[model samples]
Target: MVTVKMLKPYYIKTDNEHVRIVLAYQYFSIIIQEKVYQFIPIEANEIRINRRTQKVENIDAKFAFQHGKDVVYLTMAKLITLPDFLQQLHSIAGTYYIQDENELNGNSSIQHAVLIDELERMNILRLIDKALDERDEKSFYELVKLL
Candidate 1:
């Protein structure tokens, strides 16, 4: 059974207010003021951002985040690569943290590790299904708006 732990949040300062970001395995949850947003990691064919315009263009996904309005946008503006992501994490926590799943879990057996990987993927799919099932009309429309 896979259990999700409540991990510590990385607080970052934005122009408007301080926001808390919690990164789970393949997902990240953003806490802005009293509201929280949960997002799945979107894979893009090529993720490009114009820093001057504060516009992000992901070829695979149709999501637009303007600079100042979204705290997630502000934080993500800096993470263009793996090294950048690690640097940001280290800067926020004042320590180095790696997101290497195999190293962290210490799964030595190949077959056992594959099973674990499959289980984790299944779990994410299940959670997405649950969220879709429980979503209201407005929430559903909001997701559609992203397209």
Candidate 2:
């Protein structure tokens, strides 16, 4: 499992008691257990939210990967996009690899997990909101440019 701290934030907002941040492409990696795995993130085509729980539904991304002695046919389920938090979890559903004569056939599976804090996400949004609310064009545009 890859912890959230393993990700470097592109932007961070902090108060005396709170922290929020945004993460971007530069924050992702496909390596697992010291071995490099190849992965490509296609796109996030859908975004959903649950109003009652204030929880955002999973964002779908097309991903593909090939690893030594194993190959994983990637799908949206294997990629997790956290839109609100500006984060993404690659191989969240786990990946499988099987070694066969064809090299593409395998029965082995791999799992990579990403974690993010809801409060930290909210803090990041609020920081943006504050910049807009104050009509701080400089700060607002700076933040927007990161997106």
Measured against the true structure, the TM-scores of the candidates, in listed sequence, are 0.20, 0.25
Sequence-dependent TM-score of model 2: 0.25
Candidate 1 local accuracy as lDDT?
A: 0.40
**lDDT, each prediction:** 0.40, 0.42
Q: Per-residue lDDT tens digits of candidate 2, residues 46-126?
A: 323332332334535444433566544333344333332234322221122122444333322211111245555566678
Write candidate 1's Cα lDDT for 1-147 as tens digits.
111112234333232222224333324333435455443333321223332233333323421222244524323333333354434444444432223577546755766889988987776666556658987556556555543
RMSD of 1: 24.0
Clashing pairs in 1: none
The alpha-carbon lDDT assigned to residue 142 of candidate 1 equals: 53
